[model samples]
Target: MKGFSMYIGGISIKNKIFISNILIIVVFISTQSYFANTISQKAIIEKEINNSSRELVLIQNNLQTLVSTIEDYSKILASDYRLQNELYNDLLLNTKHEDSKPVGGLNNLSMKKTLSETISNIVEPNTKIKAVSILTSNHHWVDVGFADNAYASRIFGDGYGPEDRYYLPVWTSLIKFGFLYEGEDSVFAVSKTVIHKDTGKMIGRIFLYVKETTIASIYEEGENKGGDFYIVDSAGRIISSQNKAKLYRDFKEAVSISLPETGKDTTFTQGSGSEEMLIFTHRFEPLKWTIVSAIPMKNISSGRKEINQLILGVGAACLLLALIVSFLLSRSITRHIFQLAKTMRQIRSGQMQVRSPYQSKDEIGYLSEGFNNLMDRMEALMAENVEKQRTKAEIEFKLLQSQVKPHFLYNTVETIISLIKLGLGKQAIQAAQYMANFYKISLSKGDDIIPIGEEMRLTESYLEIQQLRYVEYMEYTMEIDHDIMSYSIPKLTLQPIVENAIYHGLKLKKEKGIIRISGRRNGNQLEIEIYDNGAGMHKNQIKAIMDGTSVPDEINGFGIRSVSNRIRMLYGERYGLQVESEYGVYTKIIVVLPLRYH
Candidate 1:
């Protein structure tokens, strides 16, 4: 220990500090990892198993409610007095008229029309319902929905016994085992037998049908949980499953496992090695359905493993972090000297802007300040100062765009949702795509500069989405020269100006407002003007904005100040924004740039 202490003391203080911190961090982290792994491993596994079971139960309840709701709807339809009367008459008519085309007579047509209207009403409210059918005891059918009646006809035909009227067989009857849903869709059916209470006579059967997606949606979360879900009957037949190829197969065939005769809802492990599965089962006893989840046991243990690995990873990270922190600590003790040395090294490598940011009243601070002043004068002489200014403008413009983005995005999302609700789905999708493009180009993967063409496209997309919400009152036109389209410009230059025109100008107009953007190049400079025919500002308002004496409220200038400052700062004081307007007549904003927009 004495020899080691002498060795540490002999080295430089920076190395000594670095070594000491590393040893301390290693010791502390090793102890923490030991306790964390030993104490929390089993607890994490147990808690995770319980959480998985709870999630399974929650998903099972959703399925239970869905099936029960469909059955209840079937019940309501079966008990419909008019529907029953129509079916009973149809039954008698089929038995009398040979059941060949029941729509031949006026009375039959009227009965069929009534049944169609009733079934349409039922299907309208529930988008998931693919079809609803009514079949008399004699196999006469009235079907309403998009699906072909051929499958329902074959499933609900006369070959079945009395048990077929229940929900389990009704679902199973339509499924073909080992047939993947990709080959043909699975149409799940729920049957309820119709009968007259007073007459004590069987009239017909009402069947409610939906695509497998409707049932799969109930357990969609389970599907994403690195597992598969199945609805099994008491007979152990797999009636509904996410991997539809296994539908209607025995549970044993899908995953063979031994079970206790407890007839209980349980979670247990099955199989060996990679074939192992963590099985979760919950019974829907009312309909004799068991919702089963077969997840890989590996998934169950992954949490425990990740926690153990995470602790070890944290230990490794801390060891690395300690070295960096110790080095920084030694340098901080003589920060002025260290920073001045670093700045000198960076300037040697041609980084002129690398000035020591440290300032103080000490002698070392004066030395750094003198060094920084020398570099500043040298930077200006070298003509590299413009690059520094351009970088500053880039950062400020990026911030400006980020600040205004959320407000515009929030408004756009509402418009998209409204379009969807109004059943203008195509328009909604188009608007959403336009919104994506607007942000995509405006952001451009952290690039503050973009082509003028890209900026125009971004502006157009923004306008399209805004027009979606105000089609009656707003429109825009762009007349930009193709030659200057490839010119480099700062991002978000024109959009904010147009946005200001719409919000502060056009929105206040009593009539429809038009926004026109025209661009032209003058020598080495490019000029773009945004004109809006609406409530224009007065001379005083424009002065307050240009003089920077306007109200500090965000909505007042409508973001024009930020755009103006950014332009002048990037190009020069000669370039920026100029406003012209007459109150209640029109507003126009002319933007000057050296072919760059910010």
Candidate 2:
């Protein structure tokens, strides 16, 4: 019985191990299949979304093309009308000889009577006859046959008045299509030339009369497609439309539609309730009118529903597959999870030395490297933050110190002005004025840059005061180009260099020293030079200043350093002030800046 019990226990243990191995194999195969399917479905969905976006863009382009074509057509029509009218008037003016022909008794009377009757019929029946005249080159009325003659009678009648004589030069210069009078009812006219059969010269003028109805007809014809089409005047008033009740209406509502300021075709929708519509306005360049076509939004988007439904059906199927695959794949994708978990756990426990293992060269590997990089960046950022805080505090202290020096100088100048006023009158006034100018520039509302002209003026004021103290010890000349005077430059950039040249370079010199200040344009750069033939520095000092390694003993190298820093900040390190000096001969400071024009 003991041997049999041992055998059964051994078999049961073997069976349990076999079942566990098979279950592991099955789970692995299923997870792999799910991940493959999920990736495939996602690709299809992304492709479809991209295609839909492209289609929408194409539709917008098509609409813009249609709007542009219509606007071009309107412009051509307006140009053609103007050109034809000018040609007709030129023909009539050149044919003054035909007016001298004598008329037979009955033939002339019958023809004149018929012409008068035709004109009266065309004019508005309610309006009375003002006058009628046939113009000659001599500026006299040849005949006034009757109240009803031809199309010309309506225009020449009482509404025109006797002062409305068509002067030859003025008539020839009139535009083709425009309102000639400002009354309740406007008149539009088109000119035509009537030539003699034998001579082939223009003997008469035929003016085509256009009443309010003519414009109304045009608007009605254009608005037949169920969208509102109106003829707007240059001032944005609706002159004619299918809806006569809305005639002469102010188009402020439509004109208020926001459009891109760039002169291009644009569309916008506005208004509400029954008035809501999508308006497409294109500028008619020749007529100076904005031809607007408004269509209901519903009309444009109605057909889109069917296409959207088709997209929806395809999208729904894709989404269902994605969800099923995503669920199974989430369990299978353990590579990224394992790496992330290891790194995170190390980070949580305050281990900055943690790094992700470079396992597979795929997205997972990239993610691991990215995490390590992020950690390195965080450490660097903390160190940089501390350094930045220290630097900012230093800069604030320097700025405060610089501010106090200017105020103190201003106060001292003011005291000197009072003393000079009591003793020396002329010197007092000059000193006070120079002092005012110097303080104005020094304070400058804390502006970093001032115009080149202003800076030159400021430097002159400073030099004026310095010359009084030095008394012909130094002579300075400034030569600046007129074109570069308006360019912006850092304030006090030239003055400090001039001061350094005067005090450090020229102070101990026995003979008179010459300081030259000049500016010139070099390609896209402006070069300013301050050179003095005074006591110059050694090579070692020049190197120290350029490298920013050593500070000057007398003055805190703060002024030169400030100018250099400002140039670097405004332009870049590539542009700044350079110092070059030769021992006991000359010292030159050159400032380089980008050429800017206002």
Candidate 3:
């Protein structure tokens, strides 16, 4: 232990901390897995046992009720005097009818019709009774139910005799040994002897047929995945089961499970070697049947096996989680050192703007602050020289469109003259004042880039001045977001677009027109849109303006290509103007600039 402690002390502090945490986590996970597996095994087995016992009790009650109901119905038919007389008259009286065919003298057909109605009335109300038949002492029989008459006659053709169970005085308990007609499967039967009250002689037998599924259906309410359910009689013969192939087979295991009539539930593990099964036996005394549920041990233990796998998975995930937590712990301590190294490399490559914003009072923070001061002094010296060169280049770019500015001023002066001549002296003064404000902001000490707020104020002045001359022909609105007012953009960017929209487009249309100016910030760029509802240009005219080949109209001074060129020169090629127009519909011009403050 002393040697291990000395080795950890030799390593860095971050590595020591990471290793210590990993060892603690590994020991905790191992202990948790051991106890969780032991407890899960016991809980799963108890749950399975309880679920099986509940299912067995539920099926037992349902079978007992079904058997009792069928027995009661059979006894009811046996005591009906009208039904007994119908069978007797049909057998004893026969004569010649008007058609010369042999018939009964006492209206035997009427009695047979009455018997048929009684059977329908009795069987229709019960969904379980598949068929009902009356067999006489002389082998003459009639059946009135769902079973085919020919099939029923062939099955019970042998009439009542000493060998038949129906000859006894009492109703027979449900028995599995019976001759089921073709197409009738997994069935059991019960019968009662119909005896004449006056003479104490056997009249006929009342046989009620029911499918064994009537009981198995109750057991099938829940899906029993692990085993097969069997309904077996006291003779150890399987009566009905979910697996139809096992019917009538001898289930010696079921009979031998609860011998000596203990009258209690029995559950045990049966079979040998790896091919073992778990057997559960339950007895129903009224029907003398045993319900055996046999599930292979391999099948029942599958749930326990899944729980074991889940525990192993959790252990592995915890180990991986420990490694991840250790890695993050080490990284947190070294983050500032790595960032300081990267900033020094950037400064070596002559990037002065890459300053570290870290301001801690530690040694690394002092180093970062010293590096930032050195870069700030260097940047101030370089910006003064760079600003002079940029201003000169901008002056050269603006001279290309200088002629348009004088022409615009000339048109505005002529509009004020027209307003005064129309006897609107008050409106003339407002137009002149708006024109002066527009030009004052336009010059802006010859700086090419100005605040967005000042540019927007200039556009409002220009539009209002134009509206005075074309008051009935045009309307205008301005929507500017307050957030982007401090961003810097090129000067006189919007006034040229708005002037063209009013004079060339809206004036050409006979209807009054609408002009809208809107500004908003989109990510790293600012979007200023000039939209107009006027006589828009055709596809060819828009292409010519974008290509800088369109001839300027007499009234319109500035061209769209000039504005697109100046913006692309100030920013990169990514920033420029986009034009969209459809003939006789509308026109929109979008000016894009980088989001920067002067």
Candidate 4:
């Protein structure tokens, strides 16, 4: 403290200030450089981890090819004609005619000699496979023979019932075949019980050795292959590896395979310090093996730490801090602007109730309050406009429906007057009563919706009056399906169509015109058909009626198109009326509507 005081006293005040500024800048630069180096190392490690995953997939493919090669060879050896014939003769055919003289067939010893030659020819070429052991239920050999009927079947695999001849060739597990490859470094043995091709018997077995070094060639592509690769069985045993020392070792630590969130394969990291490894794994389900690529975390970051990058990082940090301070100084003004922008966005998205909650006596505050007041006015106006639209729709629907009623009323009233003039007093009263019931269903307690059953009754009542008026020939039948009797439809829906059929259709026909009304469910809608053997319209007349354009006065007066329009308005555009007619042959008015029950 005394030496520092003397040095400070020696220098001027201006020199002390300049020295302090230099010291501050040096300290800031040094601290920023250390942090920058850490960040860069982490980034490098992340990139390397991604590269390791792609490399792991390549390793998995190579190992799979090796496993597949072993499988293909096994299939070839199992189906060889000479090998199968010799084994079958020794095991099955030779046992039956042991001493019998058949000129083409060989005795057991001669059959064994031929089998050994056949097996050696298949096994010798593939250096990856070290040996072959052929055994039969009646005869057994790694090559030399011993006859034991059920011994070969039970000895190869576990869970073998007396009748079971199948042996699963699970790699890296069998100890019975260990004696066959005594001096050899065997990775696994591919074994399968050979079934007799002709008799369906467990005739023989195929046991072959796959050398351990063959697995090393799968992942170790060249001398410079970077990853430490290995195969781990389900028991945590290291089945095969590039390192010979790790082979057959209990590698319990390598068994913790998991699925990471970011990667595609079943890759997981294990342990934490020097033992920490980024272990990328792929499960080869065909061979029942888990292939792994273990990479050290330290190796990922093994590179020169460049201090030149530190200078650039420190400069960037200083600029960023300056910007942050400037933003903080102006945040009070910008925060309100941001709030106003957010409020306008909410309003634009149809949330009209949202308002800028910031309050102040500045110009911006007045603007925000004005925006909120404008939104309130807009919301109120929208409600009023929606109400007006609903009222207009209801009035239009009532008008379309009321048009049907007046036309029918005029026709019925004229029938009553004509009946009175004809002196049919009782018929006039009955026709008047039917008209009253028809209007009762039409009113439907001041509502437009009525059951389809009631609509049928309305059609019937109108027809009854028409039948009385034209007692000579007018006839009708309601053939509606009972299932849809409870479905609901608009009031006065069917009556207008039936009225149109009578006035324009059946009246013009010379034949006894019959109107058949049939209703059935069509997909999600109810279809009601009004078929009349009457004077049917041509294509142009049907088009005008369907287009809701001008029609012949007799047909147009009933407004069948208006019924279709009412249906579309109530149920949407898909539900309406359709007309199918052939001139002077038939007229079919089909009404399509949504199936509603109330």
- Backbone Cα, N, C clashes tallied per candidate: 3, 8, 0, 0
* Model 2 CA lDDT for position 420: 78
- Candidate 1: which stretches are off by over 4 Å? 1-35, 92-108, 124-127, 143-149, 164-184, 222-224, 256-261, 271-276, 304-306, 313-598
Model 1 earns a TM-score of 0.43
Question: What is the C-alpha lDDT profile of model 1 across 64-106, one tens digit per residue?
Answer: 7776677677877878888777766666766687746644221
TM-scores of all candidate predictions against the true structure: 0.43, 0.36, 0.43, 0.41
Q: For residues 449-550, could you state the per-residue lDDT of candidate 2 as single tens digits? A: 788888888888777766655757988889999889999897778876787788888886778898899998889999999999888999887767656688
Give the winner by lDDT: 1
lDDT score, residue 403, model 1?
71
How does candidate 1 score on lDDT? 0.75
What TM value does model 3 have? 0.43
Each model's C-alpha lDDT?
Answer: 0.75, 0.57, 0.74, 0.70
Which wins on lDDT, candidate 1 or candidate 2?
1
Pairs of colliding residues, candidate 1: 489-596, 489-597, 490-597
Residue ranges of candidate 2 with Cα displaced over 4 Å: 1-423
Q: What does candidate 4's lDDT look like per residue over 1-598, in tens digits?
A: 9999998899744345555555565567668776777777767766766776666677777767766776677667777777777667666565676678423343357765876666565454634676666655554453433212133334554233343345444354522233332433444667766766777666667766666766777677732225587776666678777777766677664444343433235655677887677777777667656777777766664542344455566567775664555446446556787789889998888788898897778988998889888888988998897667556556645765676568668988999999999998898999999999988887788877888989898888888988987877679988899889899988877877887787788888887889999999988989999999889989988888767566446534436776776677678778888899899988998999888995
lDDT ranking of the models: 1, 3, 4, 2
CA lDDT, candidate 1, residue 46? 68
Q: At residue 268, what lDDT does model 3 achieve?
A: 74
